[model samples]
Target: MAETTNGDARGASEQGAGEATNPQQFTIQKIYLKDSSVETPGAPEVFTQSWKPEARVELNTRRNTVGEGLYEVVLTVTVTATVEERTAYLCEVHQAGLFTVAGFESNATDQLLGAYCPGVLFPYAREAVSDLTGKAGFPPMTLSPVNFDALYARQRQREAASAESADDQETDNPG
Candidate 1:
């Protein structure tokens, strides 16, 4: 009986060690430029204008499950440069990456996909926008770095507040 108990204990320990060695895995499968477009409608005329262009940048991120433990995260960046209220140029870039994230809870996975993935892809998107502007006969537009973590947190807060307000309104109306 004592020998059998000792053997069982050893087997459990070995199982635990095996699990430790093969811990939860997270990896990036690939990163690529999913799509990109540059529109210089004003073109030659805009180029002739002074270099004082007002630049507007919009950024968004989306994620979808590709397969088990695999997800596709796309970071879309749109840049529009205007001069004297006329359109100078418009560029959009969709930077995407395939990530394998396993052994994480739903909330953690959400954060990873929403914030961390976009943070990783932002620099590439930024560079693409800059290159597009430079290639469009204009100086490269330097974009400031974004804090995706903070943005994600704020977005979550707003969502929660909206939900709470909706619940309050429903209770007040009771219809």
Candidate 2:
């Protein structure tokens, strides 16, 4: 009986040691320019105008799980230039990056995709937008820094509040 117990303990220790030595593996499968467009309506003449151009920028980000541990993050940036309501140019760019994640659970993966990945991708996207706009005969547009983590937390809080309100409404209307 003592021999059997000693063997069992050794087997358990071996299993644990094996698990600890298992390598963490990950790879960036691909990174590509998903989409890009530059529209300059007042192209040739817009460059001659002495008036300062005002720029409006909009940004969006999304992520998709390509495989078990592979995820693709897309950052979309749109910039529009106007001189007192006269459209000068519009440029939109979608830059994407592929990432491999290991040892993270589902919720953790989601947070990484939503916040961390976007944060990593934003700078490249911003630079691309600025370069495109500059080549399109407009002033370089610098994008402001984005706090994706705070944005994600705020979204989660809003969702929870909305769900609670929905539950209350359902209870009030129950026949």
Candidate 3:
């Protein structure tokens, strides 16, 4: 009887240990340049202008579910540089990566995809933009490092605010 009791205790302990273990995973499957374009509309005439280039840069990130536990993140960057209020060059780059993520809650997964993955891809996109600018006869454009974590948090705040506003409107209308 004592032996039976001991065996049952051991089995329960083993089950508890198994239940407490966490199997979390994050892996980078691949990284690549998904798309890119460079245009020098001003060309020769723009080159003659003084090198006082005024540039505008826009950045965006998006994610897609590739398959079970697999995800794709794309970081898009656009740069337009003008000399003397005339267009000198325009560059756009899309850097993408495939990742395998699992064992996390939905919110955690979203953060990983929205912030961490894009952060990982930014350097590649930045380099591509710089290379494209240099190739377009302009100085290499060094993009400043981005804080994706902050961006993600801010985005979430905006979404929450928007939802609250919608809810308020619905409550007021009682529809």
Q: Give the Cα lDDT of each candidate.
A: 0.91, 0.83, 0.93
| Regions of model 2 farther than 4 Å from truth | 1-29
Writing each residue's lDDT as its tens digit, candidate 1 over 11-82 gives 999999998877667798999999998998887898777778888999999998999999999999999988
Which of the two, 1 or 2, has more TM-score? 1
lDDT of 2 at 160: 95
Tell me the tens digit of each residue's lDDT in model 3 across 1-175: 9999999999999988876796678999999999999999999998777788899999898888999999999999999988888889999999999999999999999999999999999999999999988888788999999999999999999999999999999999995
Evaluate model 3: give its lDDT: 0.93
lDDT of 1: 0.91
Which candidate should be chosen as best, given lDDT against the real structure?
3
- List, residue by residue over 118-154, the lDDT tens digit for candidate 2: 7887888888888988787667778999999998888
Return the number of clashes found in candidate 1.
0
Model 1 misplaced stretches (Cα beyond 4 Å): 1-23
Best by TM-score: 1
Question: Which ranges of candidate 3 are over 4 A from the true structure?
Answer: 1-20
Score candidate 2 by TM-score against the native: 0.79
**Position 2, candidate 2: lDDT:** 100
